[model samples]
Target: MNKKRRLALAIGAGVAPLLVVTMPVSSASAHGYISSPPSRQAQCAAGTVECGPIKWEPQSVEGPKGLTSCSGGNSQFADLDDDSKGWKVTPVGSSTSFNWRLTARHATSTWQYFVGGNKIAEFNDNGATPGSTVTHQVNFGGLSGKQKVLAVWNIADTANAFYACVDVNIGG
Candidate 1:
């Protein structure tokens, strides 16, 4: 090859590798989880509780809507379903706030809070997009002591929903 051709080829080879390395990888588009009154995944992320893969990906416990599990039915995060995992329970009053930290905000349908088999609170967004942070005041009427609260974030345009479980000591 000529000198000019060899120089161009060498530069092309160097730039090709960088272009490939900088390319974005496909990942889940929706990411949000309870932060305050830290959810199981949050606890795992914070190292407050020793956990499995969830420790690395606390906001990725996503599954189909209407499922009732801390891990969002994701087997990789099934450790969140283990009640004996010694999750730190946050103490709260009768009515308290639950906060969420969103990494990728998507159009939301509703935010639901459930205790036991019954849904205690729900806030509908009507397909509106939310900010990076969201908070809701939930009243735990007639409920007391240690309780596991399941929070679901239903995406407006998809069948999937993000799930988080918050262990709280109400009236403690």
Candidate 2:
């Protein structure tokens, strides 16, 4: 009953699945790097939302745990795909009903949501006109117990500058 086993058990018994994967907080600069790979399993507790493991160059590096923000823009919980691009698959739980939300800044942007590499939904944001935040919500359909939910935000092709990304795994 080491740490990992204990964590797995705790998560299984909890209301929502736990994020068991953890990544290094700091690392050297690299081009087109992934802040938090999909392996870092994290839980989305009720009333608690966790941002993504962001990856970007040095200057725009500003966020929780030294997660860098892509310069010139920012997007949070924008799901990513298998290619490590801004589109990935996410699993869901047997709960069957949930709301997936995303937040982004800097002009108009697109937020893409997917489950197991399939394009399931999309969100749009037209930057704030009066210093307001842009938030998008979509229904979590066809999700089952112990499923994965991958949410991605496509800030801009020219520059990465993303805010955050997260996957909420529900059920025991």
Top TM-score model: 1
lDDT of 2 by residue, 1-172 (tens): 8999999788787734323221221222211112222321122111122325432121132222222222212343332222343233345443333222222223435555555556566666544221222334545566544434444444443344332334445443
RMSD of candidates 1 onward, in order: 5.4, 15.6
- Tens-place lDDT digits, model 1, residues 95-156: 89999998889899999999997999999999999999999999999999999999999999
Candidate 2: which stretches are off by over 4 Å? 1-104, 126-133, 161-165, 170-172
lDDT value, residue 104 of candidate 1? 86
TM-score of each: 0.84, 0.35
What is each predicted model's overall lDDT from 0 to 1?
0.91, 0.35
lDDT for model 1, on a 0 to 1 scale? 0.91
* Alpha carbon lDDT at 135, candidate 1: 98
Off by over 4 Å in 1: 1-30
